[model samples]
Target: MSLTDDAHLPPGLALAWGAPAKSNRLGRKPTQSVEQIVDAALELADADGFAALSMPKLAQKIGLTANAIYRYVRSRDELLVLIGDAAWGAPPDRVADAPDWRAAAAIWTQAMVDRCDVHPWLCDLPIRGAPMTPNLLGWAEAILKVLTGAGLSPSEGLACALLLDGYARRIASARRDVRDSATTSVQPAAVTRFLEPRLQELGYSILASMMAGNEYSDEIHDADVTFGLDRILDGIDVLITQKRSSV
Candidate 1:
């Protein structure tokens, strides 16, 4: 369905598409635009995390009353959808001379990771449903095109796209978790020190050995993300190979 099709669009989705909510105006014209509200919301989320996006708080940041904020958004949930869509913006430009579908897919997935790095709050936003916003659907379309170009059926291509998208999100979420933990509580170094003495008694022999050898570091998380992403791509390669063989 088209992004602008409002025949049966959900209220939150309509808002994402800039559909003004039905408003009963009383006095003067509203001061803030939906774009302004979403921008302020993004700023607030970036500064204070997604949990800090209450209407009152957002209004305070935007220098508007809480009720005035509702003129642009129906509720926090709708506002979140708007913020997410705006933050995601547009997908990466398609590489005109990408050598293979795998290269194209890698570029697409890495772009998503880079986006999440910029807006780590994206990991905190709850997944209400599948991609409905223009940019999100665009990203999905790009990946699906790559997969289908590699010989997968549309259904298979969609499945593979979903797999890759999920993998990207998982890596982003994991990165967010590490970031949040570092800011809020005990640092990883301290945690490692605390756990080093107890690992043998706790029966985590491999973990204990790594800790004992001073092998744990932030780079390990980066390595894990690379390993997981490459492994998933490798599996997709097997599927693509089988599809070509059957043809």
Candidate 2:
């Protein structure tokens, strides 16, 4: 029935959580459902971009008047909240069964990156704050559960989850930029090749050495993600180890 007693709750958010809404249709039974609306919005976003999603465009796509669409969703912002939750959907299953927290956390974080792969527009959504919606919070809870099980306190676990969340966001942002960049954009490897010979001529032997074997040159991809995960998880491991020692 009612999702919450608080009347201030936005209709779209309540509907996203499967909560009942304040019916506004006057003497007319609904012709469509919120799920259908959200699904169409998602398809529009996936095909175009998040910028193309608006009440008017969505209405045209779904055969509803611009104003009529408001009968299903309150506003553009509310629609975005629903889209985000839908985009994230749910966390990877069985992450909790991993042999260790570090392994589980790795699976969880990479899964976030993979989600962005499906919906590249996800990275464009401005993160107003921490995860609060059903699906997003489910992701956070999954990560926090693993970290807390590894002997981290609740606060410590939350902080670690934030770290992992930011890491995933950054990775997705980098991937999106590279994907959306101009065709003429120079990749790091190309730049490195261009700079290699000049680097030694400019008294930059160390720079030339790293670029000699392409060690310091490559496009951002899973390798970078693995490198970052290793360092971040290593730091967390140190903390967990210390907590274990003290206990």
Candidate 3:
């Protein structure tokens, strides 16, 4: 069975995929507003990595006691979910009216990457559950609509969404690393020295070669996102063509 079908997927993911609802109980009364807490947490995350985001630190930064913050969010993981959705909430207004589904998807992918560019810490958060919040669900719905027009099967559409998001997050991580190295004036050779061994192990020696000389220029501008999106769309286009020919 696919990993998507694994029993270990998070509860929210199961629910989003039409699994049984686990609970209907009401949540606790809020003392701190969700917006206030999320705004403070995002500030901390943008300044520091996610590891720096403990409940105590967030509380201190927000001028509240650590325990007081709990009235808003149950845990740091929950805060992460909020921040991820919030950062992605500002997806470009243009995605809905691109010239074609492929063009729309490419825009969608870049918008996601742009969010990560501002919130580098978001690149590290794990997507343990399916989307439940409005911002996240809206992005998902947008991608689903684009994919539906591309003629992907339901499962293909879902997988394409996951793959595009995953690529965007990975690019965000790479952007962070590249920026840090540049700020420190670390030599490309030094980066290659450390990463080359790992690259070799992964059989990505070609990437190691590119990193050695800074050959991977920033001229690419979201091209990583566009390239992966186009490849997926090309596959879907084949399916669309087949359906048309059969008619």
Candidate 4:
């Protein structure tokens, strides 16, 4: 009874949609619920960093043996995905009718960033494939819908989704690096101490020149998403105009 046999579905769309409710592993209910396990994992990550998350530690936290944890999650990576999806939760609500396409798109991007700020641990999820969870796919669908309505072709809509996701991940990676460094090192100001005097000796003039040669900022702040999304949408607007003209 695989969904694949249905002719109406896009290829692999059923699998990509997410796991079925009928296959929820009902009989295998552990002594501890999935919510308990994920909450324990997230708390551990928030306190001690992602590296501190181990099977034994998580099992101990949730009152289960290390081997027992595998019944619920096949691997550490899968557990990580669950944690990330949990951390992300539901997407923020947006107006049914945004004044314009770019406005609608910016709202979508900002909602993602807000989620990232709330659950910084989400930034650690590996960037390899479509999220195999309903909530995450819903978020992706919303983003793509915004682009498609903005006069982008299907391929262009997909490209926009990838590009926006790349931007979000880049920002998240910078934050993760800073947090990891602080956790592992004795020197609290390692990055700043290293860069401060170098800039002081050279001054803003040479710093500006060096920056021109290498464009990109390592800072993970609200502006990272806002400025980047605005610039990206501006480019998309130009493309939309061209697309309309060509038609």
Which candidate leads in lDDT?
A: 2
lDDT (Cα) of model 3: 0.71
Model 3: per-residue lDDT, tens digit, 55-93?
999999877777777666656766777777777774577
**Stretches of model 1 off by over 4 angstroms after superposition:** 1-8, 20-24, 94-97, 183-205, 217-220
lDDT of every model, 2 decimals? 0.80, 0.86, 0.71, 0.67
Q: Assess the local accuracy of residue 29 in candidate 3 as a C-alpha lDDT between 0 and 100.
A: 48
The alpha-carbon lDDT assigned to residue 103 of candidate 2 equals 91
TM-score per model over all chains: 0.84, 0.90, 0.71, 0.71
lDDT score, candidate 2: 0.86
- Model 4 CA RMSD to the hidden true structure, in angstroms: 6.1
lDDT tens digits by residue: candidate 2, 1-247: 5434635664356777787545767546677788889999999999998998989999999898877888888789989989989999999996878898989999999998899989999988978777778998899899988999999999999999989888998898788887787476667677887899899999999879988877774358678899999999999999999999998
Q: Alpha-carbon error at 108 in model 3, in Å?
A: 0.6
Order of the predicted models by lDDT, top scorer first: 2, 1, 3, 4
Query: Which ranges of candidate 4 are over 4 A from the true structure?
Result: 1-29, 95-97, 175-225
lDDT comparing candidate 1 with the true structure: 0.80
Return the top candidate by TM-score. 2
Residue 75 shift from truth in candidate 1, angstroms: 1.4
- Which pairs of residues have clashing backbones in candidate 2? none
Give the lowest summed-lDDT range of ten residues in model 2.
2-11
Per-residue error (Å), model 3, residue 136? 1.2
RMSD in Å for all candidates? 3.5, 2.4, 8.0, 6.1
lDDT of 1 by residue, 95-168 (tens): 32578987888888878877888999887788877789877788878888888888998899888888888888
